[model samples]
Target: MENVVPFKIQIISILATLGFMYFIVRQIIRGKLREEYSIVWFACTIVLLIFSFWRKGLEQISLALGVFYPPSLLFLLAIGAIVTFLVHLSIVNSKLQSQIKDLAHEVAFLKEKQLNESTIK
Candidate 1:
């Protein structure tokens, strides 16, 4: 037997997905979220909306991917997305650290040169 989600649940899920999409858009409009970062959120929400509308499609995808349990597949995808996003953030953090270090060194050098010139004058 194919796993089936109740009609009420599907409606709720679709509403939640739309609510999430609205939140993302609002954030972008408010300048709290950048469009580049919002792409992933929008993509994920769209997938959720599609799945919510096509109830049995997830099962078909799960079976095609050799995942015996559809919910497990969903969990796997969510975890994967989280991990990927985290790694991206980590990379950005590293770059920012390097840039901060370089800026600090340049500031120190400029301060030392200014002090030397003032002492000579």
Candidate 2:
């Protein structure tokens, strides 16, 4: 019975991962999610699905890494993925901020020039 429980859990995990991947792809297809963002999500889901399908491999890795609890490894991977995604977003946000500032300055200068020309005319 105990052996059956672990097998059931593994099956459920794979199904859940598949469902998540489907949701992410659907969002991308609907244009609700950008491809750039979806790429990270897809990679995360794929990694999770791979681990779920290969439970013995995951266990071996955990043992080799000296992690007593194999499930904790999953949490660690999830955290790493989230941190990577956030860093990517932060970098993109910084670039967009600089571009917006430059554009605002250019618009202001152009408006000032037009105002001066009108005043002189």
Candidate 3:
């Protein structure tokens, strides 16, 4: 015989999921969660919904998209992208620091030159 669960349990699970989604949305609206950060949560919700419902169509789409493990793969990709972006930002920061130092030296030299010229006059 196939295993069976009560309808009420399934309904409770669904309501719980909806409540969780509502909480996340409220946090997002209140600015506790940023838009970019929320992408991960939204993606997680989609993946969770698909797995919880055992949706064949979603599984097929995941397979077609070459995501062997949907949740893990998506998380890995997001982290990888964030790491790459941070690396890029570090490089930009170094360049800006060098420029700032150059500007500071130039300002100091100009001030010294002006002071010397005024003293001579």
* Window of ten residues with lowest summed lDDT in model 1: 1-10
Candidate 3 TM-score versus the reference: 0.48
Which parts of model 3 are misplaced by more than 4 Å? 1-67
lDDT of 2 by residue, 1-120 (tens): 123127888889899999999999899889999998887788888887887777687777878999987778878988888898889899999999999999999999999999999999
TM-score per prediction, in order, is 0.86, 0.80, 0.48
Q: Is candidate 1 or candidate 3 better by TM-score?
A: 1
- For model 2, the superposed segments whose C-alpha errors exceed 4 Å read 1-5, 117-121
Cα-based lDDT at residue 67, candidate 3: 77
lDDT of 2 at 28: 88
Q: What RMSD does model 1 have? A: 1.8
Report the poorest 10 consecutive residues by lDDT, candidate 3.
1-10
In the range 1-92, model 3's lDDT, one tens digit per residue, is 12122456546656676777888899999999877756766765665555456534444655788877655554675688678767866996
Predicted structure 1, TM vs. truth: 0.86
What are the clash counts of all predictions, listed in order? 0, 0, 0
